[model samples]
Target: MNIDVLELTAELVKYESISRATNVPVTRHLAKVLRALGFKVEMLPYTDAAGVAKLTIVARLGRAEKGGLSLMSHDDVVPAGSADDWTGNPFQVREHGGKLYGRGACDMKGPLAASICAACRFTAGDLRQPLYIVVTSDEEINALGAREVVDRSKLFADLRHGYGVICEPTCLQVVHAHKGSLGLTITSKGRAAHTSSLKGVNANLKMIPFLNEMRKVNESVLTSRRYRNDEFKPPHSEWSIGINDNNVATNVSPAQSVCTVNYRPMPGTDTNALVRRTRKCASDLGLKCVVHRTGSPLYTPKDAPIVRTSLALAGRRTPTTVAYGTDGLAYSEQMKQLVVLGPGDIAQAHTVDEWIEVDQLHKGVELYTRFIDHVCVQGLA
Candidate 1:
């Protein structure tokens, strides 16, 4: 079963597995393919917050007791927006000028195809250890699929002391660290009434103080050395704030106002303290504060075995850090070593007419094949 990487990538992109919808279709297809390729496939199913049924596929080949290489990629992609934004159908692959264009072409499906093709090059009997392929859902939204795999999958449990690769778009460069994310929602409630009556409490009035405080916090994070990590570009934790009110008419007093804060935490930064401060401010203002989602930053030392091997495989001299988050945040603690290395550039991801160079896909297959040969077949750490 020598899978063509480009064809596999095209097949994957055709599935409409956007983060908000169920990824069962694509995942089930992948499960079938893996099973045909002589891998034991486990389907982990769960319902998302939207009440949509979702799934994660964990497939293993060879001796699955422990200590092998794990390749991770997410099946779901961010929405491609309007069809007018793309040259062709965003759900279909369009190859031109030595590039493949599609929604997840660069962000993930291409890399995922590369890994599956690489693993297919070897049989279970040829491996001294195991090769695990994890296709997760909702990674673009909350990484809940990865969290579920980490919490429940027995196959994932067997990855202890193993080397892992998160196939995120890094242009084949080796990434040792990436920032984490903390999402907070703050709410203010008040009585609603016509503005002319002046009889209702204004939720915005109550939220104004909190917004001012958040502005101060955001400015502080942007300028203070306390929130800085020199290893990443721009060096400071990004604190982003957004506000919304459901009131449709300006003549009516808003009954509720909502504020959302998304903070990126670095490896050495005190994220808990920042959360505490936010909660305290909300409490003092009589606002309800909720921690919606939290993802830890991935930090693998540059000297780690995975980093060294990945650098060599990718032909890079040194490991670098990224500001974006990945499923690596969920698996970092379980694996002995992990690195983010894959095809395409991050700049091409999530944009209109997203694409991966044809040359990148070819090189990706070669790179992943070498990596599988090194860590799984050759059993080298």
Candidate 2:
């Protein structure tokens, strides 16, 4: 059977590429498709040994030395919570009412299929700059796959001429800016002792007041008028306490406690300032807490050449900002101009019965074709 875009979507969904399992199968499958299209392919695997596995596929469709265009995407899909939540088997592809339903359908497999279809359609004589297909295994998990690809100096250096397109689902819209994220862990340490000793210090006791104080800090965030960017819904930084680990019997005083705080910072917000304030808050509570900066935020100018070209191809005059963050943060400094354009709505991603409109798939393939043609084939200014 021919590997058409829709058929490719079905094949990708058949493999349970959930983060908890191996994504090697899906990456290998995509590599096979790229290879059939006459692209040179390589495997860039990432493993932490403790069960975290990531893979990125790099394929070049012409002379490697020539300047090339790169299309990147992730193959991993977030786990489908509660099998009962889905109307059909989560792993099986189903079509209903003009939509294709399955895990990773919209969050990215659909776009990946469309991109590959566009590559197969392009004629040899039409090519100008080389076209590169980059498939990674862990974008759902903090863009781990893309991170590994960018870390390699040689990889980034070789394709520097190509304008990078992150084919993440955006319902065919072009996204230019996304917020940054910072995760902080707060820990409280104390001496453990028998409950009979009333004077014994219980780390749990210290945490109560501090936790209450942290609530105030979280509330303060909702009221702040700083870092305003009205383009995003409830535009401003958002703060929340992620995890609180304090479980102990009443007879014994617990020795340790931890609190994880996540902040989705708005554009231009001083992340350092927020981190410093959180550390001070912990100190005042008499708890020693260490704050670690998580990921960098991606910011691209609206007037950048690549952004202009992408928007023009999509027939839009302006770019949009999304609330979620992407690996774009990691490479923002080196690749200053970037955009996230793909098929599907972010709402369907990571949800049971995830799906992508068939029409979106068609539009995506055409968009990729036009984009590649304009940037790589025609080299239009």
Candidate 3:
């Protein structure tokens, strides 16, 4: 079957894989396409703790040994908000003025199409090194699918080859590093009573001092030169807390309040350390602070061959780091040498009407083609 990158991107966008419940169709669609390409395909299935149908599409086109590169993208997208907010249907691809607009158009499906097309092109030419493709679920949902891939243990060793390219939107710049993010929950307890009862402690009142302390933690991040990375936009680790549930029904004092803090930690800074510090701060404040869960930051040196060649082909400077996390960290940790390069801009992703430049998509095709040449045809053989 002939594959048109743009059309495939459009077809992919049409599938509303909002969350795990709706991901089967998208994964099957990708698998069908890959199977037709003559690759050995595997459906790695797992049931989440919540018993969601989780599947990862893994296909290999060549030998696994001696190491090869795989192209990866997530099949899921965040739920589209308010239909009235978009000029057109968020699920339907609309093209005007050299741009393709739709949900997940920029978030990922755009790059996914480009990567698949590049792989098809490479396979058509009988590339020597193995080329693999994996379309996994749950990237937008706490990195669950990727964490499953890692936990499976044997998948990494089974790959035979190690390197991978995470087709995340990067506007064609080679993204070698990116920060890690963790979602934390903090809770404060108090006694409930009437507002007139001066003796009753307001949970809202107890949260104020702790919130200020959280702000100080964030501010401390801004001043920490140790966390600086010139490649990232903000160039610093950041932390912010929000009261997810704050209610004191006016006359009555609420007994409990919960705050969710989002922490984005840079490569040099240890996410664990920051998490530990936050927990201690919560402890010192006499509030229950939970570490929740965390992910490792991704960092691939710019000097690596894959990074250098990717930058040289794109004719653009390699970014130091992207503030947003990707499936790249898992790939890097598992594959050891992973480079992130793809089309579209993060700014456009997850917006009401996400779009990708047609020209950028074409450029991505060319870059991926050249990368295949460097890694498989020219470099591998």
- Each prediction's TM-score versus the true structure: 0.98, 0.91, 0.90
The candidate, 1 or 3, that scores higher on lDDT is: 1
Best by lDDT: 1
Badly placed stretches (over 4 Å) of model 3 are 47-51, 122-125, 158-161, 191-201, 246-248, 317-320, 379-381
Residues 122-185, candidate 3: write the lDDT tens digits.
5635666777787878888777777766666344565525567888998887788888777888
Clashes of each: 0, 0, 2
Q: For candidate 1, write residues 307-357 as lDDT tens digits.
A: 989988888999999999999778766665888898999999999999999
lDDT of 2: 0.78
Clashing pairs in 1: none
Q: After superposition, how far is residue 289 of candidate 3 from its true place, in Å?
A: 2.3
State the C-alpha lDDT per candidate: 0.91, 0.78, 0.78
Query: Which has the better lDDT: candidate 1, or candidate 2?
Result: 1
Clash pairs of candidate 2? none
Candidate 3: worst 10 consecutive residues by lDDT?
153-162
lDDT of 2 by residue, 1-381 (tens): 235789989999999988767898889888888887788787887784456666677888766553567787888888988878899988889999999999889988899888888888775456777787888766665667776777763556666556878888887788888877777778887767787987557676667877787787677777766656777776866678764545467777777878878887776777776677778878888877776535666777788887888888988878888888766755565676578898888888877788999999999999998988887788773
RMSD of each: 1.0, 2.5, 2.7
